[model samples]
Target: MREQIETADRRRLLSRLAGDYHVQTARRAATFMSRDIVTDMTILAITRANVRQITASPEPVAYTYEGVAGVPADGLRIPVSVYALAKDLGLPYENIRRRVKKLLDAGVCITVDGGVVIPGATVVRQSNLDLIAETQIATEKFVAEAGRFGVTAAQHYRPPTADLPKQIIRLAMNYFLDATTFTAKGMKVDVVAVLVLRAINMANISHVTHDPALAVTYAGMEEILPHEARQPTSVYSVGRFLHLPYETARRAVIRLEERGLVQRGPKGLFVSPDVVTRPDVLEGMLYLVALTEAYLKDLARVGIAYRPNPGSPG
Candidate 1:
C-alpha cells in the first residue's frame, strides 16, 4: 500500500492549491458581494475557519438544510473572532474590525454567543441560480483540468444538493488561509502583497494569450517570454482589482522588484521569469497537484457524483 503523506505536508499542499484557487474564487465572491473586497474577504476568512473546524470532525460532515436552534443548518456555524481574522489573514486589526462591523450591519453575518457567522439567509442570497450555474461550469472545468495530472478517478462526482457552490467556496477559503500562513513564512511578506504579484502575472498572461489557439501553442506549460518582450501592468489596475489601496499595492510591487521577483515592463510591472522558475515556486506547483488529488478524495467522501467533464481533453 502507498504510504499516506504526513499531515503537515498534506496541509501545505492543500494551502498551495487553495491559494491558486483563490485567484479565481475571490474574484467571483467579490462580484457577488457587490465588489466590496474587504467585506467579502472578511466574511470568507470567517467561513474558512468554520469549514476547517468542521472538517476536523471525527466523521464526514453530513448535509443539512434545516437550522438547529438559531444556527445555520447547511453551513457549519463556526464562530470566529475579529482578532483571529486579523491574525489569520495578516491584515491589521482595525481593518478587520471595521469590515466585520460592515458585514454585521449589512446582515451578511450575525453575531452568535461566542462570535460571528454567516447566516443561512445570507448564504441563500449569495448562492443564487446564476452563481450555481457558474459554479457548476467552473467545477466541471476544474475537474477536467485536474485529470491531466492523473487525479480524475472521482471527477464525475457531483454533490447531492445545490449547496456545492457554497462548499466549493468554503474549501477554497480554508485553503486560502492555509496558503497565506505558509507563504508569509516562506516569502517573508504579507499575503495581500503576494496577491498583488499574482494579479500582475495574470494580467500579463491575459495580454499575451489573446486566444485559446495561442495558448495551445504552449501546450498548457508556462510560456516563457524574452526579456525584451513588454508585459506591462499598471499598479492602479492591480489595486482596483484586488480592492487594495493604491499606495499599498505600489509598495508591494516595489518590494517585489527589490526582491527580483518582478520587473518594470513596457506597460508597467510584470513577473520575472526568474521568479516563476524559482525552486520554491516549482514546489508550490507540485503542492497544487497533491492538493487536487486530496480534494477529489474529499469530494468523493462527501458523495459528489464523480464523472468526466464534457470539456475534458480526453
Candidate 2:
C-alpha cells in the first residue's frame, strides 16, 4: 500500500490534535503531570505552527555569515526564524520544529526572534549558495538524539531501534509529554481502547504497526524491567522511571494501586486488567483517552517496547 505522506491539510490537523486538550481540564492535568498543561498546550500549538510554516520544503541557501557560521552544541543562543532555518537545511519544517522543541526543553536551543538561533548550529558559507551539507546532518543528528517527532507517528523516527529503550522511547515520546504519571491518567481513560491509538502511532513513526495501548503497556514493562531482569516494580520503580527518588515513584504507584487502576499480581503490581479494558466512568475521561491515545501511538511507532504481560518485555 502507498504511504500517506503529510499534506499541508494534514499538518494543520496534526497541529490541532497536538493542542486539543480543554482549558480547565488541561490545568488539572498540568497540576497532576508537573508541567502546566496550558503551557504545554501552548507549546504544542506553537510547535505545530512553527513546524508547519517552516517544514514545508528544505533548501540550501548561502549564509551572510551573521554572528557565527555554525551553532555550538553547548551554551545558550537564540534561534532565527523557524521558516528560514528549515529552508536553509534542505529538510522538512516539521523535522526542524521537533528538533527545536527537544533542544529547547533540554536547554540546547534558546529562543530568539520567536524561534531559534545557534552560534555554531550549522556551517554555511556565502560562496556555496547553500548551507554546508555536514551542518544539516549534524542538526538532524542532534535532534534525533534529543527525541523529536512529527505529525505522523511512522515518520517520527528512522532507524529508531538502534537503541532498544531509547529508540522505543523516542518513538513513543510524543505521547509521554513531560508528564509524571501518564499511566495513572490513562486508567481514568480506557487503557484497552487506547491500545489502538498506540498501534497507529507505532505505524506512523516507525512505519511499524502494532496494538497501541498494549504497546505502551509493554513499553512501560520494558522500562520497569532492566536488561531482562523482572523485579517486582515497587513505588521505587516509578521514582526511578521519573529519575526521582525511590519515595516519589513509590507514592505515585501506590496511589494508582489504591485507586484500583493497578494491582499487585502474582509477580508484581500491574495495571488492573479491568481498568485496562473498561471504559471510563468519569465523563471527563473521553478527552484524556483521545489525547493520551495519540501520545502513546507516537511512542509505539518508534520501537519503544511494550510488554502487556506483567514483568514481560514484548
Clashes of each: 11, 42
Per-residue lDDT for 173-214 in model 1, tens only?
555555545554466676666677667766766534333343
Q: lDDT for model 1, on a 0 to 1 scale?
A: 0.58
Error of 2 at 302 (Å): 13
Model 1 residue 15 lDDT?
28
Name the regions of candidate 1 deviating beyond 4 angstroms. 1-21, 55-71, 74-76, 126-133, 148-163, 206-230, 243-248, 300-314
- With candidate 1 superimposed using the best TM-score fit, by how many Å does residue 173's alpha carbon deviate from the native? 2.8
For model 1, what is the error of residue 32's alpha carbon versus the real structure, in angstroms, after optimal superposition?
1.1
Candidate 2, residues 252-271: lDDT per residue as tens digits? Answer: 45555555655565655443
Candidate 2 ranges beyond 4 A from true positions: 1-52, 56-232, 265-267, 281-314
* Model 1 error, position 171 (Å): 2.4
List RMSD in Å for every model shown.
6.1, 15.6
- After TM-score superposition, the amount by which residue 83's alpha carbon in candidate 2 deviates from its true location, in angstroms, is 22
Best by TM-score: 1
